[model samples]
Target: MAPPRAEWLASSFACLLLYGFWGFLGKLALVRGLSSSQEAGLEKLGFFLTLPLILKPSATDPNAGPGLMERPKFALLAAYMSGVTAAAADFFYTRAMMKGDGGAVSAITASYPPVTMVLCATFMREKVTRNKLMGSFFTLLGAFFMARS
Candidate 1:
């Protein structure tokens, strides 16, 4: 069965708020002279601490998800790749914040879906529909305007 729309909406809102605060707080930490990227390193360490808690398996859980150790090697590898990329992205984003406006940095970087779409199209043979093309156009358009200000 599909999840309820309200649940999806709430989750999306929560994600928006969490990411917004992440950018704000990361920039603030840099502004406060947390130099040498130790602050960003702690942010990555927090992800490490949360990963186990987030992936803990439960006997009575409805999904019957696999624990970290039980997951397939491929899945584990993929997850590790994602984590490494995220850590790199966060480090660069924090570094950018040290020299750029947080809002503009986020606005420009968040418009990266177009690149993803193109890569998936070329690499994974994904279809690029008209709607997605239009959306990508508008995303870049808005990002351009945002960066100008």
Candidate 2:
């Protein structure tokens, strides 16, 4: 039931644009004198506002998974922990953005993929190819240069 390559690519492109716009909007909000905590709280509220759309079964695929409350306890715990961690990260990220240049904050945060790569390689036994290593090195180098801006 996987989507076609075109669909995947289109969705990824949309994600890139949406995330970029989101950060830009968030920075604008911070510049408008909103407290970081208030920004984070309102952001979570925005996420909640979209829950219905996310949870509803779509026309193309009706076999949506079980309800969140109906899932296994372990699954529920994992989901809850994921939200908790994301909320904490969002709070810290907004705090950083509020105190520093948005571009620098964003550039530094964009380097997080290397951490994910390392974690996957260590915990999930994922292969780290030479290309991946080179890409990560370049990404980090770019982040370093941008963070100095």
Candidate 3:
């Protein structure tokens, strides 16, 4: 079953807000005394604090989930790749924000959904709808306008 449209929109918006703030917080931390490792440690601390609130208690079995030690090697590799991508994106974004026009850089980066959609279509055999094509066109237009301004 599909999620309600309003719920999907609300969740998307909330995720955007959370990541936006997270970026800002990370930048601030960098400006202050935190080294990259220290920043990562702090982020892990925050995750530990908040994860319990977000995860629902299991109805069938309480302690059935894999412990950190029990996670497989492939899962660790996947997690490492995820971290690498995140770090690279964050580094480039921060560099762009510092050197380039902030509004333009942010506008272009905010258009990532179209790129993601295209990638999904290519790799996951997802159908590209007319609406998605139109959205991609507008996203490119917005990025172009921002870059030009």
Provide the RMSD of all predictions against the true structure, rounded to 1 decimal.
Answer: 3.5, 3.5, 4.9
Better of 1 and 3 by lDDT: 1
Given candidate 1, what's the lDDT at residue 113? Answer: 89
**TM-score of candidate 2 to 2 decimals:** 0.82
Off by over 4 Å in 3: 1-4, 20-79
Q: For model 3, what is the alpha-carbon lDDT of residue 74?
A: 83
Q: Compared to the true structure, candidate 1 yields what TM-score?
A: 0.77
lDDT, model 2, position 39: 87
Give a tens-digit lDDT track for model 2, residues 1-149. Answer: 55569956998889878878778888999999899988877888898998998776776765456766786898689788988988888888999999888888888876787888998899889999897899999999998998885
Model 1 score (lDDT): 0.84
Expressed as tens digits, the lDDT of each residue in 1-149 for candidate 1 is: 56659956998889889988888887888888886288788877787798998776767667576666887898789889988887788778877888888899888878888999998999889999998999999999998988886
Task: Please give the distance, in angstroms, between residue 147's alpha carbon in candidate 3 and its true position after superposition.
Answer: 2.1
- In candidate 2, position 57 carries an lDDT of 72
After TM-score superposition, what is the CA distance of residue 35 in candidate 1 from its true location, in Å? 1.8
Using TM-score as the yardstick, the better of models 1 and 2 is 2
Would you list the clashing residue pairs of candidate 3?
Answer: none
- Pairs in steric clash, model 1: none
**Candidate 3 has what TM-score?**
0.64
**Residue 22, candidate 2: alpha-carbon lDDT:** 75
